[model samples]
Target chain A: MAFAEFDLIDTYFSQRMEQRDDVELGIGDDGAVVTVDAGNQLVVVTDTMVAGVHFDQDTPARAIGHKVVAVNLSDLAAMGAEPTWISLALTLPSIDQDWLQGFTHGLREICEYYGCQLIGGDTTQGPLAVTVTAHGVLPHGSAIKRTGAKPGDWLYVTGTLGDAGLALAARQRRQQVSDAHYRRITDRLYFPSPRVALGQSLRGVASSAIDVSDGLLADLRHILKGSRVGAKISLDELPLSLALTETLTQDQALAYALTSGDDYELCFTVPESQRGVFDTLVAHTASKPVCIGRITNEAEALQLTLQGEPWQLPETNTGYEHFASPIEPSV
Target chain B: MAFAEFDLIDTYFSQRMEQRDDVELGIGDDGAVVTVDAGNQLVVVTDTMVAGVHFDQDTPARAIGHKVVAVNLSDLAAMGAEPTWISLALTLPSIDQDWLQGFTHGLREICEYYGCQLIGGDTTQGPLAVTVTAHGVLPHGSAIKRTGAKPGDWLYVTGTLGDAGLALAARQRRQQVSDAHYRRITDRLYFPSPRVALGQSLRGVASSAIDVSDGLLADLRHILKGSRVGAKISLDELPLSLALTETLTQDQALAYALTSGDDYELCFTVPESQRGVFDTLVAHTASKPVCIGRITNEAEALQLTLQGEPWQLPETNTGYEHFASPIEPSV
Candidate 1:
C-alpha cells in the first residue's frame, strides 16, 4: 500500500524540522506563525525544481534535497538577508520511503547548518517537484539591491565560476573530461554553497548584488537593468577552476564561464569609494572576491574584451532560457 | 514559439499585483522585502494542487486558479490572520496563452479583492501544478489553534458540508444529480469564500479552530488529537445544503457529510463559558454557524449519535487519503 499523506508528513517532515523560539506554531498547523524582528524587514522568495528538468530523474534524493534549498537560499544571499525560516511544497509521483528518508536527511542537515528552521510545507502526489519558499530578515533599509549600482562601481564575484556549467556539459555528454575533473565539476553542480555569509558581510559595502544563477551574463543583465547601467567585462579576468581550464580548450572554458548557468556565487558591484572597505572585508571572509569588470553608463550595450581587444559573443553563446530550452537534466 | 518565463511573468503577474506600501520591494527582485506591523505575527501556509489529482484535467484554468488561492487563504482564515501577500509556484507543460490569461485573470481578481499583493514566485516548465504560499498577519499571540479545545467545549461549523463530495460523485458518475444541483455544487467547489472576517471576529471566542479540507470527521479528529479530548457529534445537526439533501439519499448524504472532503469551511470549538459571546458574534456575521457537537473528556474514542441513538461508523467510511485514493477532481 502507498503511504498516506498525513502519516508520511508526520514521519518525514514534522519531527525532522528543528524548533525555534520565533516559531509560535510550526508544521501540523493550518499555517505557521512566526514573528519578524521589529527593526527588520522580511525577505521572501520561492523557487521550484522539477525532476528530469532541474535534475536527472535518477539523481540521488539527497542531492536533490540539498540543491533545492540551496538555490532558494541563494536568492536571500543576493538580497543580503539572514535566512530565518523556510517552507517546502513537495510533489512526488509515488511514495518512496527510502528516498524520503534520504531527502529529509539532506534537507535537515543544510537547514541546521544555516540555523534556518523549516516551519511548514505541503506534500502531494504528482510529477516530482519541490518548491521551496525561503524567508529571511534584514535590517530596515540595509538590503542590497540591483538598483543601487552606480556607473563607476567595480563588479566582483565570489569564488570561481564555470565549474557547475562545465560539470553540466560533461553530464550532458557535450564535452569530454577526465574522471577527476568530472568529480570536481559534479560536486560543484550538486552541492553549491549559497554565499549567505559573504552577502551578509557585503551589505554596506556592495552597491548592487545578485546571485549568479542563469549564468554570469544573464544575471549581470538583471543588475544592469535594475541599476539602469551597462558594464565592461574582462574575459580573461573571469574566474575559472583548475579542472575547467585543464579539461576544456580556452575558448570552450570561456564560453562556459560566460553563459553556463547554475552557479550560486554572488556577483556584486562596489562603488569606487567603498573599494577600500570591501577589500578589507574580503580579507577576513572565507572566499576571496575577484574583480572581473566595471559598471558603465553606456546603457546601449555591454562591452566585452579579451586581453585588451574587443571580442564578439558567438551566436551560440547564450544563457539558459526557461522557455526556449528543453528540460535539460544538468540543471 | 512559446512565451518565455520572463515575459510571461511580466505580462501576467508583475504589473497586475496591487501596490502596497508595506512591500518595500516586490516581484522581480532577488526576493520580496516586506515590513510587518510591530504587534503582528506573520502566518504562512503553502498548498499544492496537481492536475488530474486536485482537479480534473478538463477543469477550467480559471477555476483552478481561483481554488488554489482560495484554499491557501482558508488556512489564514482558520488562524484569524488577514492575508497580505501571496507567492505562486506554477509548473506547466507548455505555454498556452489563452489559458494563462484566464488563469492570471482569476488570480488577480481574488488578490485585488483581498488586498493581498503578489510578492514573488517561480514559473517553471514541468507537469501541471500550482503551489501557492500565502502570508498573513495577526495580532501577536491571538491566533486560534486546534490544541485550544478542552472538555465541555461546543463544536460549530461554518456553512454547509458534503456539497463538494457529492459534486465529485456526480462527476465520476457514481451518483446522479440534476443540472440545478450540479451547478450549485460545482460553484461551491470552485469558489469558497474564506471566512476571514468571521474568523477575525471570533479570535478570542474560538477555543480551537481548523479548516474542513478533509471532511468534518477527519478534520475534527485533528482538533481532538491536539487537545487530547474526544468528541460526540450529532449527525442530525449537520448543516447540509438543499442540493445535497435533495440529490442524495438520507444515509448517503450523512456519510458524505461525515467523511467526504474539500469543504474549505471552518470547524471550531467554543468553551461553554463563551457560548453567549460566540452566539452574539455569530448573529452579526454573514454565515450563521451551526452547533453540531461538544468536546468530551473521553479521550480514547469519539462518540457518534444519530437521532439520540448510538451509531457505529462503517469500516469503509474514511476521509480522503492523498496517497491511497484516486484523484477525485471536485477539490
Candidate 2:
C-alpha cells in the first residue's frame, strides 16, 4: 500500500524521539506541549533545504536529512543554547520507502546525539524540501549573541574551513582534487557536524558568536555589523584542512575559505583576558577553535593582511547571497 | 536593486511584529529567545502550504499568506492554547517586491489581530512554499486533546461546513455556482477564520477537540479513533452556508460536507453536564457551534443517521489524504 501522510509519519518520525519529562504531550496531537524549565529561556531557529537549490539532485537522502538538522542545530550552537526539541515540515513529490528509511535514520542519529526530541511536524505532498525548526534552552541572560562582540576581542573559529567549499567546487567541475582529498572534502560538505559542544562551552567565555554557513567573510561581517565593530584578520591564519590545501593552490584555498559557504563551525570572539582560559577549556575537544584575528574599532569595514602586507579581496568575492548568487551545493 | 534575503526580511517581516516583553531577543539574531510564562505550558505546531498543491498558481499572494498562518493558528486553537510566537521558513523561486509586500501585509494583519509575534525566520530561494511553526501557551494541565472524549458526550462543530469544499469543486469546474455564491465560497476557501476565542473558551468545558480540516467525517473519525469511541452524527443537522446550499444539489452539498476537506472549523465534544454552560459561552461568537451528534461506545466505527433513519455513505467518500487525494484549493 502507498503510505498516506499519517502512515509515513508513523513509520518514520513518530516513535523514534527519546523520552523527555518536559514534553508533556507529543506527536499525534494537533500540537505538541512542553514545559520550559524555570530559569531557562527558549531559543527558536528555522532553516529550509530545498532539493536542487541546497544540494545536488542526486545527493543521498541521508545526507540531505543530516544537513537540514545540522544547519538548524548550528544556529542553536551559535547562541550557546542546548537543543531540546524540533519539528519538521517535510514536502515531497512522492514517497520512496528506501529514501524515507535513510532519511529517518539520519534524523534519528542526530536527535539521539544531541539529546533533542522530535515533538511534532507536518508531512505534505509537493516539491521536495525539508524545513526544520529547532528549539533550544539556555539560562536566562546567558545565551551568546553576535551583538556582544567588542573591539579588541580575539576572533576564533572552530574546525577547519574551505573543505566544504572545495567539495562543491570540485562537484561543479570548477576545481579538481585527488581521490584521497575528494573523500575528505565531500564528507565535510555532506555531513558537517554542528559545533554544539564548543558553543555550549563558550557560554560565559565568548563575547559574541555565529556559525559560518555563509563563509568566514560574510558571517564575520554580520558579527561586525551587529556588534558595531570591525575585524582585522591575517589570511595566513585561516584554518584550512590538509585535504583542501593539497587539492588547490594557496590563493585558491584562501578564496574558497573566504568566499564559499556551508562550513557549520562556530566563529566567536573572546576578550583578551579570557583568551587563555577559553583556549584551555577547548583544548581537549575534537574541534578545538583557533584564534585568527582581533576585533577592531573601525566601525564597519574588515581589515585584512597577508604575511604582514595589506591584502584586498575582490569586490565580488563577499560570500553567498541567497537572492543574488546562483544556487550552489552546500550543507 | 534586487532584494537580498536580509533586505526582503527587513522590508517586510522584521519591524512589523509587535514588541513583547517575553521576547527577550527577536529578529536579526541567529535564533530568537523567548520566555514561556510560568504556570503555562508551551504548545508547538508546524504546517507547510505549497504553491499549486495547496492553492492556485495565480491565487492572490495576500490570500496565500493569510491561509498559511490561518491553518497553523487553527492547530493552536484546536489545542486550546493562546498563540505567542511564530517562525517562518519561506522558500521562493525568486523575490518579487510587490508580492512580498502583499504577503507580509496579510501576515502582519493576522499577527496583530491574534497578538502573536513573528520572532524569527529564514528566507531561502527555491520553488515557492511557506512553512510556519507556531508556538502557543496554555495553563499547565488545560490543553484539549483528541483522546479525552467519552461515550456520552455531545459532538459539536463550529461554523458552517462545505463552503471551502464547494469552492474547490467550482474552481475545478466540477460544480457551478452564481457569482455571489462564488465570492462567498472562495472567501471561505482562501481565508477561513480560526476559532481562537471559541477554543480558548472550550478549555475546561470540552471533553475532546479537533479542528475540522479534512471534512466532518474524516476529522471526527480522528477523534473517535483517539477517544476509542464511535459517533452517531445526524446528517441533516450539519450546518451549511447559504452559498453552499445554493450552489449544488442537496446530495452534493452533503457529500462535500462529509468528504471534502479545508473547512478549518473546530469539531469538538463536551460532557452532558457541561453542555448548557458551553452553549452560553459560545452564544455570542461570530461562528457559534451547533450540536450534531453524540459519542457512542462502538470502539472504532462511526454510526450515521439522517432524520431518525440509519444512513450509509457511498464507499468512495472519506476525506483528504495528502498522497491519495487530488490537489484542491483550500485555506
What is the DockQ of the complex in model 2? 0.70
Best by DockQ: 1
Candidate 1 local lDDT, B187-253, one digit each (tens) = 8877777777877877889998999988888888889898899998898898998887897777788
All candidates: DockQ: 0.77, 0.70
Give model 2's TM-score for chain A to 2 decimal places: 0.96
Q: Residues A212-303, candidate 2: write the lDDT tens digits.
A: 99888989988999999999898888898897688777777787888789999989999998988897998799887888999999886898
Tens digit of per-residue lDDT, candidate 2, span B70-170 = 99899999999998999999988787878888788788888888999999999988778999999999999999999999999999998888889888888
TM-score on alpha carbons, each prediction: 0.97, 0.97
Q: lDDT (0-100) at residue A267 of candidate 1?
A: 96
